[model samples]
Every structure is written in structure tokens, then in C-alpha cells.
Target: MYEATDHPDDDVVAIGPADYPHVRQFVRPTRRALLLASVKERRDGGGEGSLYLLDAAHARRLLAPERPVELIPIPTAYRLDDLTFAVVQGLISADNALGADDRLLDAEEQGLEQHLQRERTVYAREAVPGLSQVGAAWLGSRFCSRHALRWLTKNGAPSALWSRAQIGEEVLPLLLFRQQHQFIDEFTKLAAGGDEQPGVVLCVPEDVVAASPLYQRILFFLALAWLEMRGLVTWVCGEPEYAKSDEFVLVPGEQAVIGTWMRAKDNIWSADVAVRKAQVRDFDLSVRHARAHSVTQGGSSHARLRAAVEYLGLEQTWGTLPRRCAELGAYGTVDMLQSRSRLIALDEVDRALRYVGGLGSA
Candidate 1:
């Protein structure tokens, strides 16, 4: 049993476990409410609503603690299985209300529906092999790309412009550029203030720091943001330009060690050890700005590697490059990169590699 609270905004409702004695008979002992609490406490000092739709045990495990709960303001039941259906349907409804062309909207809606059906089939199985680890990484990337596309559309960007753009020749470089300037602007503000202590653990949830490879990627970005905020690393164009003096250590909260058969029993490493290892290498992280050309399977290994290296260099001084391309409608780039399975304009691979590589003129 549960209690429901209504807000002025009918779309947002709060439901929590009921305290009534009779409620125990209706609810199962193993069942728990899938609540989404804020990582950061509310500034108003008010408690968050305990609204939750029941989820399966497996689905519950996927609920990341660091994930900010975004309630979709729709009438449909918010279940994990129905999430895609709910969101896509909501988008379709909005488009219809706006008097958009039915033909264009119908085509896009059908494509989204098909993808959702495939995803549903995969998740419907009782136990998916390697889903907990490998699947999370793949799913996270897809989610990030989709979320970026949704962000653009919701913010009033025309979807058609980016949806039809070439991935390697247009989208990849633009995303890298957007991310670069975001870091630059943030770091500049921090540089104005004094530097902080070297060794500081980022304030992420314990589960987030140790969860999955996807969370690890998120943690990496968060740590990078923290480092940038302290002005610990230098930026040439839009990428972190490491210097000999630029050295710092970040420790994640609640350390745990897990071992695989591939490694020796005595060679176990904790989360902090990994973070330290990343720092020692001067954070020479790979840049995969787009899915289409970033992965080896999508393009020639040699070309992708060269492009990645060149992109890193460009980040240091190629600040305005992405902005220039974006002015010509790079908004739909994310959708094309993630949603489209087949690689496009493979012949442009060599040309794009040379073009991006040659852009390191600064």
C-alpha cells in the first residue's frame, strides 16, 4: 500500500510507502519502492517526494544512485519496460499538437518504435549474459547520445538538419568542439580563484564510483571537471594540455577491490589505484566524440587512431572550430551518430582523417 500526494503541476506526483497496518497484507516483503533521491540536497531544505513505480529485481540493480531522477510528465505508468514507449509517444503527441507534418513525424516515430521494440526483446529475457557489465557500457553510450539529441530538439533546434549530416565529416568534430569550450569556460572561472589542495576525493555517491564501466566513465568526466574547476590542468585550445608541474591525485569514496582471473591474485587494484594510474599517464584519455567513426569496427583502425590523436591536439587550440560548424546546423549530429547503425560516407574516412589531422596548425 502507498500514499499519493498531488502537486499543482498534475504531471508530477509523489507516492510513498503507506504506514497503515492493513497495508502490510497487500504489499510483498521483498518489494521496495524504486525511489530517485537527489545527489545534491534540495536548496529549499524540503524533502524530496518518494514517488516510485515498482521495478523488477534486475531493473532495480540498474538504478544508479548518482542518476538525477527525471520524471516524464505523462499519464502512462512509468515502468522500466514502458519507458521508451512513454517517451516516444509523448514526443509524438507534442509534435501532433504543434500541427507538424504527419508524414515526417510518422517516419521518425516508426523508426524510434522499432528500436524500442528491439530493446524490449533484449531486456525481456530472464537473464542476459554479460549484460551487467558490457551491456551497461553500450547502453550508457546510446543513452548519452539519445539524450543529447533530445536536448537539442527540446531546446528548439531543428532535428532534420543534424539527422541528415555526415557523422565523421560534420558531427564528431562539432561535439568535440562543444565539449571543449564547455571545459574552457568552466576552467577559466576557476583559474581566477586560488588553487585548491592536490589530493581530494570527488563527492560522488559510493555506488556510482564502484558501479559499472558506464559509471566509471561518468566518474572519469566528473573527476576531470573537478580537476578543471581547481585550475590544476592547462588548456591550449579546448583540451587539457598537461605540463610537468601539473600533477594531482583524486581518490574516490568507499574503496573496494575486485579481481578477475586474467590478473594475478596478488595484483588486485582498488578504485583509487586506477585513478592514480590515470593521473600518472597525465590523463591521456581517448577521444571518441562520435560512435560512427570513433570505434574501430566503424572505420579503419589506423584512420580512427590518427583522428583521435589529432582531435586531442586540436582541443588545446581549436576552440572556435566547432562553433563555426555548429552555426551551419550541426544540431542534429548526435542523432545521426547514435541512431544510425550503418556507417555513412566511408570514402570520406580518409579525407576526414587528413582534414582533422591537418587542423592542428596551431
Candidate 2:
């Protein structure tokens, strides 16, 4: 958790654990990451997503904090990629005043427009074939209008460009090539039968998903979900991050990578969520609007009682795995990944809400 003095304008820096020495020791060219606010798409065929690596300085300024922002250094052995740079740079720029200020907004807006025009021209000449120059312009225009380009290119928007670029570069390729969808369609066709009950859509949890190629396949998930709604195969969501369980399908295709993420998700459980696993640390210090009140409750109060019961239930059923792992002294980074995954799980969220609801009912 962050300290109380952190200011809103302060930078929230994150480096891989490997990169910590660079910030701590001021070593050579250590890579660090910062987050900007989230962004949404503004055009048709556009879906909600995030932009990244646009403007770092601006992000540091706009998202002020209550404590001095610290950089999170990641482990160096973790290979870096081009997409990482694209994300970090875009996110940083998103937090800048140039993005939000109305006075200079037009200039920034024009620059974004020009960048899109250039990218489209490059894509047409380099990406599409058999199109004459004039024809290419028309085709590109049809693919994305000036209005759409303007919406996508606006640099200040968080995650807008990130998600679009990802959709364009990764998801569209998979969908258009029919590489993965062939399997999806096959499953869908199989599901239309009267005797079939389509199984859960299997996937690694989001963190593992983020680390894996599946991150790029988010669009594929969305598209397939739509297909499933039309009587396609059922999409059962799975956790690639945890040990393969009977209730979920394990994604078996990730052997190509080093399996670092898989190892991370299977780490031993702890009595509480570990300190290093704290993903969101809210630091709010504004003097309340004179309407703040403190509410006290006992540990066995309705909220705690239900959460404890549900948590104990999960522990009783699934506890053997973690307990066995812990007995073997297998604590490691996977604990962090698993805890994070649980924090984001739909089932976990629903369970928590139900627990709270039960408390109110009681």
C-alpha cells in the first residue's frame, strides 16, 4: 500500500522486479513502466480497449498521488519486447495536459490525424496488394474514415490506441487467417447437435492471459462469444494460471514459451494475500467534505462472517493443493499471480457480493 503523502500528480512508476536495481542503483538504461488512465474507442467496429506508451511525462503529471511515486523494477531475465515499449510510451503520454487542454488540443489533434494518414498509407502500400495508389487511398478511406482516424489517433486517450493497435495487429490477423477460428467453428458446429453440451470456454486467468498470446486473442474471445450466442460451442472461461482443475480446461498450446507464467500461477498459498501481491493501493488524503463517518464492526459481523465462511469453503475444497505445495516449501511468484487472478475472477467477485448480501440479509 502507498503512504498518505503521495500526491495525485506524482508518477506511479512500475518496473519489473528485475529492473529494480536500475532505479535503486541508477544503473544503465533500466526499463520502467507507468500507467495512464484507461481509454475507450470512439468509432464503429471499435471496441473498448487501452492505449499505452504515448506520453510518460504527461501521465506522471496528471495522475497526481499522495506519496512520491516509486518505480517498480521487473526482473531482467524477463525478455522485453517491442510491444512493451509501444504500451509504456503511449500510456505515459496519455496523462499529459496537452491531451486534455482545449487550447492546444487542436494542434495535438492534427498531429494524430497526420500520423494515422501516414500509417494507413504505409499499410496500403506495404500491407495490401493489387491496389493502385488512388485505389488504395479509397480502400483505406473506406476501412477507416477521417472521423474514425481522428478518434483513434487522439494521443491523450488511455488504452484507446493500445487496444486498437492490438486488435489490428494481433486479433484481426488470427480472425482473418481463420487459424484459430477453424477450431472455434468446428467446436461451434459440433455444439448445434442435440446430444451436445458445449463445455466452458477455457483460458488462462487474465494475468497469465496478459503474459500469453491469449492476451492478443481477447477479440477472438469476444467474437467467439458472439458466435456461441448464436448456438456455437459454449465458451467456458478457464484459468491457465492455476493448476489444471476438473472444473476448467487447461490451455495446452503454450509449450512454445518458457512456461514462466504457468509456474508463477501454481505457487503455494499463504494465510493472507502476500504483500508483494497488492496490485491496487489507493492513497487518498483529501480532507473529507465534512461528511465522513467511521463505521465499526466485529470480526464475526455479517460481512466478515460470510467472507470467512466462503473462503473457508474454498480452502476446504481446494486447500489440499496449496497446503501440499506449502508443505513441500514451494512458495514463489506463482502465489502472487494466483492471488492476483483470484482478485480479478468473476466467480470470486460474485461470491464476495453474495457474502455481503447475506450479511445484509442476516
Error of 2 at 35 (Å): 28
Model 1 segments beyond 4 Å from truth?
A: 1-5, 9-12, 16-220, 227-266, 269-362
Expressed as tens digits, the lDDT of each residue in 157-233 for candidate 1 is 11001111111111221122223234323324332332331211112222322342331222133222223233333
Q: For each of the candidates, give the backbone clash count.
A: 6, 52
Which 10 successive residues of model 1 have the least lDDT summed? Answer: 158-167
Instruction: Return the TM-score for candidate 2, rounded to 2 decimals.
Output: 0.20
Q: Report the Cα lDDT for candidate 2.
A: 0.25
TM-score of each: 0.19, 0.20
| Collision count of model 1 | 6
